[model samples]
Target chain A: MRPEIVMLALAVGACTWAFRALPFRFDLTGLTPEGWLSRLLAATGPAAIAALCAVSVLPLVKGAAPPAPLGAGLGAVIGLWVWRRSVVLATLGGALAYGAVFAL
Target chain B: MGEARAQFAQGMVAGLPVVLGYFPIAFSFGVAASRAGFSAAETTAFSLIVYSGAAQFLAVALVAAGTPLLVAGFTLVAMGVRHLAYGPALMKHAGQGRTRRAWIWAFGLTDEVFGVALGDLARGRRFSEAFMAGLGLAAYLAWVSGSWAGALAGGGALAAYPAVEAGLGFMLPALFLALLLSILSRRQMPVILIAAGVTLGVTLAVSATAGILAGMLAGALTGALRRATA
Candidate 1:
């Protein structure tokens, strides 16, 4: 088995166990609108996601230019998601945009 | 039908929205994974075992970029830290008397399931263990099956039309962008910008894993500081 798979299994398994066994609790009733910890946790998702997007789309490899189709597809996805609020439509729209650009 | 069976049926009904939302996204993950050169089995393992939509997609990108497994795994753990809160909040409504079953069910507590469970609890509904289980099962099946179908289709599409392969490469970034845009808020703008800037700078200077980790830390810390002072 690949080391990555093994690591994935271990990490996921540990998280699963932690979910069941951890002593953390958030009292929603007591949660203030300005609770920093809760807000921090919420912020993590977007931050991580955006970071991932940057890594995926940005040209990390030396001398490699950014993929034009990807940029166009990302624009299509953002447009469709804003207009439709539907991930399905956005993804499909992006895929089609990418295909069109690549083919051209 | 037994009470459990009835509750299960109701749970499945409630999960319909999640099923609809998850299928296409999961399909996109499959296609993205395939384009990243993951085997079908690996893709399926991701769906079945990790079962985290964002983490799975991120893992694929990281792996494709040659990130170390431990670093990628840790990144996934960080991505999943938010789920830690879900189990406790849900234990009261869904796990009540069954400890072991609840523990097992907790493994399936994706954001969608947590949202549905929370909604039910808010409405003062008596959600049963069986109901939660049913909801999880339905969503799980949809995700796994959707991934399988997507992988098969992706393979066929790439084989039949090589030009489509380049198109598929864009799927992950586009999906991430959509998710980010959907959740963007005025307050989050700074965090997102910081994360993006850090990610771009670090990835160019260091490794992808380090860049992601640095970006997440920087963004989260900034958000926390802002919230603390506010």
Candidate 2:
């Protein structure tokens, strides 16, 4: 390995370590209003949730090639189906869908 | 001591997915760096120095566009601010240690660490310092190794690895979606929707990374609005 590359890796490692070391000044009050809003957003009704899903799906039927679009659509469907309560699944599904479409 | 060991083990297991995910994305970062007139050494340095995915991508794009380094730096710092959002959640756990230690851990904190730590906290679990260290180390390796892979591949090779590359990129969104869903309650859906909508709109209108900041701002504001009405 080049000395320069080794040094670069060390630098990135140091920075990564540095960022993780920052302190958390706890002002519990920061949670007051913002916390409540996050709760509200998290609990949106099924209609709104469905709308979000629909919005995600729109990327499919609009203007794109079949492979990726199809993959995305299918992934979204699977994501929505597998983890109806999971935003992670949905997002993952979309990303995988896109990847699969492009790759396959 | 037992708690610390368990947390560390858990961190290792949980990080498996991230390691798998980061490889391709980091590789792409390397390739992009090479394409942007970066020497292999410079490409490696970027992953090491900047160490941010989107920020590095955008930085190179900006540089290519003839944007000033200052502009790139400003954009990077602005994007880095998102780390602040993850603060309170992480500090809740790391704060149990000495103030200095807490500060040190906070510096290494990234979305991945915050997500894992946050999830553990939500489950009413407290991580030993070992666990936090384990988590941070796992992500760091993935990022660095992945970056190295990309740099070694040179520019054109990434095109051949597009599937894996894109898949790794998907990990970030997937992980975020999962975390968001886990925490999401019926009450928080509107805030999420509005935030997502605003983020989407802003990204289309402004810079993509800037849109993320704007979206978070919009979400926070809307969250505040909803509370006032409630």
Q: Which candidate should be chosen as best, given TM-score against the real structure?
A: 1
lDDT of 2 by residue, B21-107 (tens): 566666767776666666776666766565665446555555565654454444345334435346555555645443345554455
- Which candidate has the top score in DockQ? 1
TM-score for candidate 1 (chain B): 0.80
Q: After superposition, how far is residue B88 of candidate 1 from its true place, in Å?
A: 7.3
Mind giving the per-residue lDDT tens digits that candidate 1 earns over B37-112? 8877778878888887777888877788788777777778777765666766776665435544665666677767
Candidate 1 residue pairs in backbone clash? none
TM-scores vs. true structure, each candidate: 0.75, 0.62
Residue B112, candidate 1: Cα error in Å is 4.0
Worst 10 residues of 2 chain B by lDDT: B170-179
lDDT for B75 (candidate 2): 39
Q: What tier of docking accuracy does candidate 2 attain?
A: incorrect
